[model samples]
Target: MLGIFGSARKTAAAMADTAYWQLIIDGVTSRLGPAEALCLPARGPSRNMWNWHSKRLHPYLPSLQEEFRRLAAYQAREAGYADPGQTRSMTAPGRGQFVVGDGAVPASPVRGPGSKTKSKKKHAREKKEPGSAESDGGSAATGGESPKVAEDEPQANPRRKDPGAGWHVEGGEEEDGGHRVFGPKFVLTSVRDDRPLSRIVLDVRYQRPGKGYGGEAALAVSMLMDAAARLPGLTGACWDGALREIHRDQLMKAGLLIVSPQHDGIAPRRIALVTGCPCGNRHDLWSKGGALREAESLDTGEIHLTPTTGSRLEPCGGRRHRWYLLTRLSCGNTHRERLDTTREDHRRGLNRTEHLRQHPPDTDSYIHCYRWRPDAESLNAQLDATLWNRRMIAYGAPQQTLVMLALAQNALTRHLHHRQAPSTTRQERAPP
Candidate 1:
């Protein structure tokens, strides 16, 4: 049976037309579901199926992986896997299944000839800015005044200066002889389970390195939203730095990220219009006629919603593109303060070092979520382990096939274990 299964996988991976093999897999899965479908193999001398499956399904791998995860979750639920707490415990300080995601560089370790190295010339001595003195002796002519010394200021030690301070290179400008096999990058999503080091892959995507991780993260977030819908309560997701921009956009779109502490718990309720009256008479503000439109920040990052409230609430100046935070005073004087609607790559709550200092990484909701993102690496490791060789044995098998196979196994195990555990209401109950 083992030999047959391996042969079938190899044959399926190498096939020219993966549609036929996919059809067969679909038939098996439709009949048996994910857990069982993964166990059984098509009985035959399978040949060239792996390559066919990879090539055929490569284009649709992200969607296919998402669909498979949903199916696996459904199947696990149907099989008596009942862990509703994954979502419910989200409100707690440090609970919930960590949906950690990251991008991995799974390359074919084949190295080619040495890449050319370029030397960068330093232009620091070429020219000084207009305000700067030409030389230390010319400080008087340049209107340079002696530096004031503060009593509380710490003395700088010339001997203790950083050796590499003047030798630093500009970021992203350092020449890297690109990897010989800078193969297609892959994004993997997984959950941190208590059982072992291995993590269960929830979704996987393949993209060329240049495409970036933001778009891929958006897809993973969509998958997470689906899971959250199914499970409910708290579903925290952790993502690597590459997805920070897209992650923030998704959070803002889903109403997960909020600027105001009072409105943090409320979803889909942005401070549409903050109207402050000087008289301190509190009045509710409603969206009379504002269309959510895209706005660009000064830095060229895309902002999903323009701060403006449209003609109905447009300020007297007709600058309808600005978001305002209103300050209400006791005298009925309403003050409108412009609100920033710019999309930033960093999260205000999580990225602020001062905020992190107060909340700490473990206690901070966003920080805690992101800290677990490294678990996705364990999923990558598991994938490599399962793929037989360090790399994928078959073409197409790495992205979705191997991932789905691992997930199916995980779903089964989770279901079986949960099935035997006492029900929520009957926990610690005497055995029947």
Candidate 2:
């Protein structure tokens, strides 16, 4: 048992080697050719995997987990499963085990240190003893850690009550029926083909339910940006319900928006900078080519601004115009003034749900180019069945162990699929 464990550790260490990476790449090149682009499927844990103490001790575990993902994709591609433009279909007719009504992902909970709750008596006693040497300079003199703040900070969430664990949610509606998953979360992308292409780990993160979809989206977007850096033409992302309107706008603003059902909406109209105030009262207020003279949100604050191009200044409370924005019109007047947008700018854009309903990307012919997004649940099911049972066997940082588990799962499943294909085909031919 000791020898087996030691050997496993050594194997993990070798995963960081350049030669090992080249070997995997060489194998993939021989089998499938170079990888082009992919539709990534992201999955979070369904259960909790760590206590507050373990999380504190292994603060850097999440970073290590992300590194493992990059290595896994590189290795899988080398292993000949994730070649560019591979024709393998991940969701062929009988390939994925899809069930009714559970297509969407559920929400997960984040586990962090609980808020410090001290009794009223303790606070009173501390106040009365403020003059004590320990309360004054003892910590500094002894070089001890600073005293912890006792305020009742907000806890992770009341819904997440499990100790030594975090929550998990898949994408989609509330009826998705997801349970708690332990360990780290991973986003994977593989070629969509029947020959079983290699899967790449796009991103990984420590499950934080408190952040809701925000944290997960950030990590996934980061990975997408990295992949875009490597493959400039990379476009599109097939995600679950986690890709909300806010996330879509963020991706669009970053210039990475592509064809995805989740990203359906009328792209926001372009806005341009304007010079020369439309008030027609010659002044330097609009002449200065520096930053905009003033900026403020619409319908929120006391912004003395208007969209009308030119009007009698007397009736309008005799307000002196400072700056203005212009649009081309027959009157050559400023049609509108630019207003700063808040974080929740979706309200200002087209309705997302309606846009998707009218023109679904799934029905569109153009989207079939990037390969269908592999069912994330299929990978999750495989991981749960093979590796993440009731409890994880590997010890130490859960992130490191979970990452290795994911890589092994991806490798093993691809291998298993190949091994069973021949026998399954023979059985199909040998009908009764």
Candidate 3:
């Protein structure tokens, strides 16, 4: 028994030494490529344990297989097989079982521990019946019944194209061509008074052209007409020169007076003329030039004559002289002379020079005036108040609001000067 143990130990030591040497050779080959002659270290656990009797041989077999696998992998890598560990099955030498090169053994196929005839008989019994569905055809047996059809197949409805159909179809053309007519709904509310004083509600339907309004002038005219129609007590509304030519007849028919500041004609009577003024530098005032000089009366041909200045004043060509009078009324402060020129030598050169010096009669800063129309002046004052109120609310600042208030007060004071009736009355009690 001792001799047998010693022999086993010697075999294990030889196998370990062989595996250790093979490992060192594989490492050297990896760095230096394959070579004919290889030298391995003489000192190692395997070499030292050669005389040791207690060493076992079973443990060394795994190390030997591992070294062989490393050598195989190195060879596979050099041969350009990217995956060195990939397996190819091979029949073990003189054995039914197979051995994997990377240290794996093939598993034996499972079989029943019975005679060949008995195994054949068992498999035959487990087989399906000859006339069953599996043997007859690939189709499964369903008691010979046919399959039912689905219900969602395409079908035509007579009213599919009709927009009034109860069901909504996406991307379908509407029956009314998807056109909407919006009635007048906007109301002008004054923020200062916190009241909606005027509203223009149109019963008419306006269509947006597939092509939009081409210019700002058209849009402004549309917005102005729309706004004016809603306001109460608005006898007439006027538009700028850009809109006058295009919408003249239409605006006049609608009871609106179209006045163009750029036009070289006077606006018709009772129609509010909106024209550019040299004084205001805006197209807000009734007209350009002088209103009084433009006015005509049945009793008096021209209400007021244009003061002859640099040249002979033309007949005004029947243009309404209202604008000239309005200009005088607007510039009443500057025109201090009374209407009666006989009592007061209104043609005094010094007075004219002083007037010209103080308020220059230049095109840029010319003074405009209007005949004192109580109703119109009152309405203008209200409009001014409303405008100031809007500015105050829009600012929403206490200081700005106070400033607007002060401005409104000043405007109201000036407006009162033109009023036929003063808001305050001065009376003295007799000898009180």
Candidate 4:
């Protein structure tokens, strides 16, 4: 009986399809007596035949389809197939599994040229579970022997050829081939935080040909000082000279500090001292022969000095001298004063002084006694009035201008909107 069962099992293995083998097993089981103990192979091999045998067994079609799916899933797990939906295993033999195609496993344990032995050793060592005494301790079972220590410890500094023969150092020179000096040597005491707060010294000179104080030098200095005072963020205004002359007092009165350059030891802070010009000669006056004509009628027979060649006069060093001061003013109310001074100068010299007085020169005659002709002022006013009339005419025609302007604006807006609007219905429908 056992031999019969063994023969049946061998015959079942020889069959190509599992359903046929299962049928044969069922027939043999039915033939044996009911009392005889009977055993059968698991349903897996029989179920595998469902895919191939289902059409023939049409009465059980749905049941066979379910069994076919179940058998395919089981085979997929056993063969390590990733996708159960696929009928065949990716690891099927003779399917180029050994070749190193894209994402395929390497043919050998070696990686590249120098990787074979190291990779094998690493893999073998890793295969053993961690904390395994035999691998970690290197076979302690062999009389509990200690591992041999390496003869020489690995040196961190490897020996290399000395190309310079001790004559060179690494990074000896910078990229620009300059030696770097490291030290805090000369302290920059003047400038702090990279800002240049430097002292600029200027020298100013005054020269006058006339004996009495001509006031030109004082006026020039006052003008320069006034300009400086109008400058923004000006800290100091000073003059470096003696205060003996009356003009020096005038300079002091005009908000300028008078200090002796010799006595003031550089003023500790940044100093800019202005002095008189080195050359004593003033600019040539009366060069056009006007002053000579004016002095011709003077009764004094004593020779009168005039710049023109026609006047019989001796050269006298009594001409007026001019000196320009250099100072800075605050940015507040001083700016208003500067503007007022400029306006006054323009009104007196530009409009009024062009017309000379018809009266004879006398001791009491003053430069400001003359007035500008009424026609001059009236002409300027007419010109202003004409300009106002033209402006009014232009403004009154604003309706026509506005209509033209509106048309232009509307056209431009339409053009811009057309350019920016959606080009196609599909593009408009696309996700924003």
Between candidates 2 and 3, which one is better according to lDDT?
A: 2
Model 3 C-alpha lDDT per residue in residues 1-432, reported as the tens digit of each score = 111112323434544576755765675576566663255445334423442422343345445433433432332222223222433211111110110000000111111122123344334434858776644544475655333324333333333121111111111124523322211111111101111221111111111222255333444445444433433222223222333334433333343322223333433222122334446521222212322222224465644333322211111112121101112323232222211112132333122111111111222212111111122233324433443121111111222212222223222322332252334632211111
At residue 331, candidate 1 shows an lDDT of 38
Backbone N/Cα/C clashes per model: 34, 35, 23, 16
- Model 4 ranges with Cα > 4 A deviation: 1-220, 232-236, 261-432
- Model 4 reaches what TM-score against the true structure? 0.13
lDDT of 2 by residue, 1-432 (tens): 111222233443443456654565555555556561122112211123223333453666656655655654443434443344543332221111111001211112233344345665446547856766656645647777546555644444555343424444554333656454433444444322344543444444443444745666665566555554443323335555455545544444443423344332343232333445465432211211111222224586653322222321110111221112233322355444322223333556533322321113443232443234444556555444434232333433353344333445444544554555666443211111
Which portions of model 3 show Cα errors greater than 4 Å?
1-212, 264-432
Report how far off residue 19 is in candidate 3 (Å).
89
Error of 3 at 111 (Å): 89
Relative to the unseen true structure, what is the C-alpha lDDT of residue 277 in candidate 2, on a scale of 0 to 100? Answer: 49
Q: Taking the tens digit of each residue's C-alpha lDDT, what string does model 4 give over 170-217?
A: 112244343432111100000001112111111111212222654233
Q: TM-score for all predictions?
A: 0.46, 0.40, 0.17, 0.13
Question: For candidate 2, which ten residues in a row score worst on lDDT?
Answer: 93-102
Sort by TM-score, best first.
1, 2, 3, 4
Error of 3 at 284 (Å): 33
